[model samples]
Target: QYRLQYKMTVREELYRQIKAHLDLIGINAADELFIFDGEADAEVYNRAVKHVDLWNHNVEFLEQETPWERPAVFIEFQPIKWKAIVTGVEYRADVFANLHVVTDWNEGDGIGEFQLLEKIHEVLAGLCGSNFMEFDIDTSMTNHNHEEVVENIETYHCIGFRHLK
Candidate 1:
C-alpha cells in the first residue's frame, strides 16, 4: 500500500518554527497561535475583538478554494483596531508571504529552526514594513483609517515550496 504525507504536518511544523521565532523575540505566541484547516472563521475575529489581547491568532493551509489559494499557508492576525468595525467586517484574503531564497525549502517540509528565523523575519519585514530585510509584496494590501493607521499584523500568507521530497 502507498500513503501520502499531509500538508498539515508541514503547516504544523512551520507554525512551531514561527511560534518559536516570535517567542525568541519575547512573545508568548504559542498560547496565542492556532491552526484551522477550513474556511476562515468570523468567530475567531469576534473572539479576537472581544479579547483583543487574548484571542488565538490562526493559520491555515490552503487546498485551493480558488486560484488565490496557491500559497503554502495563510495566517489570520488580530485586527489593528476594534471599534466601529461594523457588524460583518470584511476580511481581505490578499497577502504574499515568501523569503528570497533565504533558506532551502526544497529538501522537505521541515525548514530547520535557524533557517526559519530568517524566513519569518523576511515575511514580517515585507508585510509589516520593517526594514530588517528587503522583499517584494505586490500581493499585499493594507486598510487605513484617518492616517492613524494600525496595520493588520495578525494575518499573513507564507509562500513556500509544496513538493515533499
Candidate 2:
C-alpha cells in the first residue's frame, strides 16, 4: 500500500538553497559597493556572511537593539497555496517570498546596501533545487525603517512540488 509522506516544505527548502548559495558566494558588508569601472562585483572577497535567516515581517523587530550583524539578508514567505495533483499523492505549491537586504547606512552613503542587493538578485533570480523551480523577481523597492540601517526588499515567486509513494 502507498503512503503519503512529508519530505520538506517549499519555504524550508528555498531557505536552505538561498543560504547555501549566499554562503558559497561569501558576501561581506565591509567591501566597497562598486568597482572602479562603475559596476558591482559579484565576487568581491571571501569574507564571512554576517547574518541570513527567515524574517518574521515585523518592522519593530529591527528597531530594538539586537545582535544582528550588518549586510544581513532576511527571507520572508507568504502563505503557500497547495493543490492536489492527479498523480497519486502528489501536490503542487505556489510560493511567494520577499528578500530583505539590510546593510549599514552612514552619512548619506548606501553603496554597500545597493551592491549587496544587486548581487543577491543576480544570484537568486534563477535559483532552482530539488523541491522548487526557478525563482523570478516580481518587484523590488527601498524600505526605510531603522535610522542606522538601509534595506531593499525584493519580491520573488516560484512553483514547487511534493510527492509520496
Candidate 3:
C-alpha cells in the first residue's frame, strides 16, 4: 500500500512538472491528456496505443481540450513494473515510467511534432537525475500508425525504499 502511494505521488509530481515545462515552452492546451494508472494491466509497448483507443471524436471533449492546440502525451507504467530488492535489512526499488507522445504526422510536415517532442524530452530530462531517481530514456522501441505516431520514452528510478515506505 505504501509503495503504491509513493508511486502515485511520483506520478502526480511528474504530471505537474510536465505541465510546468510545457507551459514554459509556450503550450497551454493538449488534444488528449491523461496520466494513466500505471498499475493497469497491459503490454509496455502497447499501453499508449491502447489509451488512444478511448478518444473517439467527442466534440465537447475536443472543444474542452484540443490536441491541435498541443499534442497529446500519454503517461503510463511499464509492464516490467516496479520492482524492489531486499538487502540485509534495507529495500531498494525502481519506479518504471513509460511515456508516449502522440502527434499528427501532418502537423507542420512533422517538424512541429518533432520539435515539441524534443522540448518534452528536455523537460523530462531536467526533472530527474543521478541524485536518486535515475531518469533514463529508452527510445529504442516505438509505434507509429495512421495519422498518429506514438513515441515511447522509458524512465527507471532506483532509490532507497525506506524513504518511500
lDDT of 2 at 65: 48
After superposition, candidate 1 runs with Cα above 4 Å error: 1-8, 27-74, 77-142, 146-149, 153-159, 163-165
Candidate 2 vs 3: which has more lDDT: 2
> Can you write out model 3's per-residue Cα lDDT over 45-153, one digit (the tens) per residue?
1222222212233222444655442245556654333344543443445555555555545645655655655655655563652223655455534455444443434
* Better by lDDT, candidate 2 or 1: 2
Model 3: how far residue 59 lies from native, Å? 16
Write one digit per residue (lDDT tens) for candidate 1, span 1-165: 888765443334444444433332211234232222233432332211111111122122113222221111233332222222234542212223332111112334333323333344543444222111222333333222212112233334433222323
Q: Candidate 2 on 1-165: residue-level lDDT in tens?
A: 977766776778899988876654453465533322222444445533468888866345666547687677789998877788966787888788888777677756766566676667766788887778978888888877677777788889998877664
Candidate closest to the true structure, highest TM-score = 2
How far is 73's C-alpha from truth in model 3 (Å)?
1.0
Of the two candidates 1 and 3, the one with more favorable TM-score, higher being better, is 3
Clashing pairs in 2: none
Task: Give the range of the ten consecutive residues with the poorest summed lDDT in model 3.
Answer: 45-54
Q: lDDT per model, in order?
A: 0.29, 0.72, 0.44
Itemize residue pairs with steric clashes in candidate 3: 31-66, 31-67
